[model samples]
Target: MGAGGDAEEGVELEAVREDEPMTDLDMSRACVESCVRFREGTLKSSHVFASVSCPILHKLEEALFCFTANTTEDASILSSKNATPVVLPFLVRFVDFDNKVFLEFHQIMTDRKFRTGKQLCTEGKLEEGLKLMKEAVDINPTKAEFRGHRAYWLQENGQFDEAKKEALTVLIKLNPSYLMAYQVYYNSCLLTGDVRGMQDAILRMKSCPGRVTKSRCKIEENEQILMILKEFCVRLTDLEKTKNFYEILKICKEALKIAPYSNEILVKKGIALFGLKRFAESVEAFKEIPSYSTSFRLLDIMSKAEYLSLKFPPAMEYNRQAIDLLNEAAPERKNLIKFRESMAAISEEIKEVLIAMQNKDWKSMQERAANTKNLINSGSYKNERLKLQMMNFEAGAFVQQKKLDEAFVLVNEVLSAWDTNYEALSILVDINITVGKYHDALTDLERLKGMKKGVDDQMVDRRILEAKTKQQEMKHATEPPTRFLNLYTMLKLPVGATDSEIRSQYRNLSRTYHPDKTRHLSEAEQNDANNRLLKIQTAYGILSDPGRRNNYDKGLAALESRNKTDSKNGLVIRLEENRKKYPKVFGLASSSEEGIPSGSSATPTTAPSPESTVTSKKRVQQEDGVISPDKVKRFKAN
Candidate 1:
């Protein structure tokens, strides 16, 4: 041996001599030192030494063996223990070893589970996929990615509520700025029709407090949100065709959550609410549109809603604003001008009706009510609430004039068509009281009180007391009249009849009641024939227009729901009464199979307004600051 070999041998002999005297504790400590050096790459596995066997030393040896052999599973298990007892001081010296091992194992298991879950979901095994996804999340609770996967699958499984809850967990607990979680939540809310939840999700995405951390591409994030809103806008147009005003409003609310100032969504929302007869809410939706908007459609719709809501000043202001925005050559300009004229006429007639009622002039009240009806029936005006008001006023006039039969007929028809019309119900109660039918009066009064809960309590109570007192003197009780004279009934068509069926039936009825056909009858009969023709024309006007027909259908549904005991028997009775009263006019003998009245030609026409009488489409452009025809055309083309 060389001198170097001899020197190494002498050192090993001395180390063995030193190791021989080491205690079990000392051996454990020495083993831990060896393990640390091995982990730090400062010592080779072959050179590592242990002098004696001990529990702690054994653990350290096992851990080092697994680490060297690349058996991460066993190493991870060994690390998850009290290092000072299990692996002596090895893990304590490498303080991050246990954590690092745990993290690696967690990542491996979570990835395996997540990938398996995704595959399962893609294979349509939702329940199994969901389980695996949940397990993945459990294995790595701090990672938002696992939770987001679980949430999306849950939504696909139709577990919307659970999906949203899981998504919230990611957004709130794991990752406050997680974008995927927000998208999952939004989709869940949308499918479930949770409007407020969808809105919240949209708002959160748009204004995420930690968006910088959540997304790398801000433009992509914004495009995603805008895409959602665009989808809602497209849905609104389809919903309009269905006349599902409620659904349209919900979609608008959701879209507005992402873009609160979207003019298109707001206008659609306003129109939907207006169609629903929610005039106040419609006005509120319209008001959200920026006042600087020059949209003619927006202003026109807002004006109509405001007018029906009885906000006359604002209604007129909106109309004038819309007019100022239009040119004389615009087709809508003519319609708008006619609309403004009709509004003015209706307003004047309403005031006159009120004044007549105040003055106890039944004739004047009836005439003004008739004028309002004529204006509404003219097709240029379209105020739903105003039409109801005029009907109530007309009935009130008949009641005050002591024409009880006429009053009864009108009130019954109105109530049957609009059972929740408090004004018509009140008029019916008045008629009952005027005829000394206290029982009927009491019944109507109680119904009114219930419907008007928390309103005019004192007035309702006084009326109830009077009705009860008068009941003691009543010896007879007759069924308060109920009649169903809906638009369908007026045209003598089935409830589910098609538009063509409606037109054909309308033509048939018009021909039967046309003055030219009924001219051979007596003068009284001819007058009755004219009245029937007018009613048929009004019915056609309502049923022909899709929007008006939808509103009427909705009203009919509400009426049926409110008056659950409504009977077709009442309609049969009313029809019989009509035949008895106007035998020569309504009887079979009066029916004529003569020519059909020209549908459009027979349509009632009002005298041309001063604005419409202008033969020249050209007007002074400077007046009202009206844009020129050419400019208006160009602006509209955009």
Candidate 2:
């Protein structure tokens, strides 16, 4: 007979034998057919499936075969009575002609068991879940879905290697396109530091051509992609924390390819680049983020990159924006305070540099620049722009000190690295002008003008004019006469003055032009006096010692002959002019009929006669008691 005639005959026989209870075999067969009919939507409005109030049916109706069947107690009873084996044949008979039905049955059973295991896991019964999941996998050894669940439980319980093996079995041996299996495999690779394996799994899942026909599996494909990207982001964060910037950047790029518009991933990529000292690239990465995204972290990183790149104005603007966004963002963000403090410190450093530049404090500027460079080198600061600014500042200081070669080297280094650096270019132009390299200065100024977006073009134009004027004036002039002053001219003395004479003049001039003596004068007058006092001290120091004086006389003679200039004539003119300008300082009288002192015939200065010196000594002895050696000896003997 056909299967339909056999079913009808069986039903008729059951009705005829109503007085006798149905055998376990009969009940199992009936229950299996009922489940199949119900799944097919042909059977309806029946509470009892096989002469028993089955809770599994109720659970299936409520959870739609997605959750665990809360019938473990009944299942245990059935298993203990050896009823599963009797039921197994009926299950096979109902699904024998339809592989779809068999697949659905296995899927439902696997999902139920996996849900039960997950519940146990949530209830602090991890070991119980592990054992139950293992049993589920053993029952359906060929089902990739069940093995994927088992792999997850294994990973949760710290059996990473075993989890990886199980996941690989599911993906490679059973179902190559299983999305859940790929997730498990990816996570296992991540935890074990197998980055290559993780990457391979990501590529495999991405390239999956939808082998699994289930709608749920198709939905899981997108979900698995998201999960993998999130996992990579987490790993990137961990790597960044350990300062593994290169690895972080690599992972960030990999994740970016999956979700190109993901703001979180882009932010992380920019941060990694910033950590790697790739400031320009880092800024470009951050710029990929959409304008509407309210991410303080993104703004902060962009500001830092700009600052390091030496774009101070923009860096400050970005910093303000970041701070404002942080205030408007979630108040519970843990890094808010720390980020603010860091920004504040950077702002302070920039302010100090700006102030020094404005005041033209070359020495202070140089010192601060050194300190900023140290901070950058030590990784305390990550602003490349700040480092460039510091280099420019030091070069400016060198220019002020007339260290042209050193200044040129540093300025060129900055310009080569960042051609658009306005400050560095400006300083380079100034150095060129100072060294009479007018053509070079004009070239730099032209470059600067071309790149001057927000800067004062008028100021640059004026500088250009000044450079042209100086260049023209140089053609007519005799190479700009160098002002070389000898020690005698500096101290207002003749070149051949003796040591005692130089010392006497130095004492008088120092007291007269001292800063303390000029305190009552105007600020300009006081500054002039201070400068003069410094020059006088330097000249006196050079001409005070006999050895130094001898060397100075020789150098002075050589310099005078080289230039064909008589500085002694200039010294005499300065002495006469000073005698009129400050009469009390240079009004010492001279005797013309007296002879010059011994050992100073080169100076040609006349003094009072020898009788005048004896009379002055006798007067000093009468005023202050003078004791002879004979008188002292007689008194001691007494």
Steric clashes per prediction: 0, 5
Q: Once superposed on the true structure, which residue ranges of model 2 sit more than 4 Å away at CA?
A: 1-258, 261-268, 271-350, 358-360, 378-385, 397-409, 416-420, 456-462, 476-638
What's the residue-level lDDT of 206 in candidate 1? 61
TM values, all candidates: 0.41, 0.30
RMSD of each: 26.3, 28.3
Model 1 local distance difference test score: 0.64
For model 2 the local lDDT of residue 189 reads: 67
- 1-638: candidate 2 lDDT, tens digit per residue: 33343355554324327787666555655665666565556865232253433334322322322112323234334344434455543333332234444345545555566667778977879898877677667756887767887788787776777888998898778987777777777776655445566667666776666755233333455456657866886797788677676777889788866755556677777877766556778888888776523666677677666655545455666766766665446552335444445545555564565567668887777777777666665543444445666687778787777665566667666655555566667776776565454655676677667564445688889999998887666443323236776678788888777778888999999999977788899999998998899999988887787798788688777866755443334433443453354332112223221111111111212233434423332111110011123322332342
By summed lDDT, which 10 consecutive residues of candidate 2 come out lowest? 618-627
Count of clashes in candidate 1:
0
Pairs of colliding residues, candidate 1 = none
